[model samples]
Target: MAGYPQWHTASEQGPRARNADAVSAYAAAGAPGITFALADGVGDDPGAGRAAQTAAAAAARTPVADGPVTAILNAQQALRKLGGTGDAVLVVAMPFTGGYRIAWVGDARAYGWDGSMIRKLTEDHTMAEYFRTRRQPYSPRMEHVVTTSVRTTTAPEIGTTEVVGGGLLLTSDGVHKVLPPATIDGILADPSRAAATLVSTAIAMGGHDNATALFVEPPEVDVAAIVTEPFPTAA
Candidate 1:
């Protein structure tokens, strides 16, 4: 393994955002690789915000299971074990031996950047889409309102994806709803000032919700190799 995982994590309770709908994490020290998770609580439910916090921290504390798929399943199962009372979305990722495993549920998103291009790793699950299928008008609510989450009932339906060679970003809907894809790309590109800029922008944009972000940049593999390798065995 090479490149170290350096991250900038930050969150802010926005001006109009009543509840802190977001929770985040950076690379944990002396833990199972670099694991990060983020969650956005649905404001409609009273216990939703707390659910987000509980889910995010629980997910982060959990180790990477047999695989990404297993991890997602495990997280959903874990949330079910807890009294997850409201709708929420969670995103988790870790740098593995060969690549990275990224998984998500509900709407919180994961984004990846390979120096030039930034791509979204998760999709939104909402009834609005069903309405859209019927040629209905799109009605938007608080970005934190989610149709799916870790509730007290059934387990969460999750999604997973894999990526190699790039930096990763995780955020709640508050940030995505306020900024466009291009804007997110610009912010993540500047690793040095990305987190501060992101939180500031969300706050300035009338923060209608608690906005949080966890940006992870993988270090250069060659440099890590140079630092670790004992000797130049061959050319």
Candidate 2:
């Protein structure tokens, strides 16, 4: 692979009772692969944050060959094994050829910011998304209920896309739910500060839950080195 994976991971408690969100990133040693994961514990359930942390750790520690979906499955199963009090949404990302692959459940999401555009990679497993797809009237209350998640479940939505010059982001609803796409698109100014900026923005926008973001800056090839230089004329 010509590119490397660089990551900046961050999280915040927001203005909520507890930080129910977790994020993780790992780069394969001597390999062009990287793995990233984020989870948001269902606030209604006690010990939700613990489940989210467990899922994040499992997903991030997954072997490269096991793949993204497998990692998520591990996370889901791991949480189930813990016998925790709350369920959670799990989102995992990994390098895939020229682009990246994302596997997710529930409302937490993955996004690609390639400088000029901000692309949403995963569809929320919430009623809002369900209604949007069917072109039905969506009630605001429906947003509170997630149709799918890592509640001892195996199914997850998977997406793939080449990265934008900027990078990739995995976010919990605490951040995505509040910040408009334009605001996120505008903040691509610095990927290094993106995680903190996103968390801060979500708080400023009205922090309702624990916010989290994991950023993956794709490796770049030196264009100057790739371009051929003219041969110097013999003196």
Name the best candidate (by TM-score).
2
Local distance difference test, candidate 2: 0.73
Return the clash pairs for model 1, or none.
17-208
lDDT of 2 by residue, 4-66 (tens): 455676787866777878777665444345567888998834588888878888887776567
Give the runs in model 1 whose Cα sits over 4 Å from its true position: 1-3, 16-19, 22-32, 44-46, 69-87, 130-137, 142-145, 152-156, 222-235
Write one digit per residue (lDDT tens) for candidate 1, span 1-235.
Answer: 3445567777777754346355544333344455567877766455676667666766665555444444445555655676544556777776565456877777788888887667887777566654666787766752234555655223345677877777877877768778777887777778977877887797787757677787777555521122222211100
TM-score of 1: 0.77
Evaluated at residue 179, the lDDT of candidate 1 is 79
Kindly report the root-mean-square deviation of model 2 from the true structure over all alpha carbons: 9.0
Residue 32 in candidate 1, Cα distance off native in Å: 5.6
Residue pair clashes in candidate 2: 114-164
Instruction: Measure candidate 1: CA RMSD.
Output: 6.9
What are the lDDT scores of the predictions, listed in order?
A: 0.64, 0.73
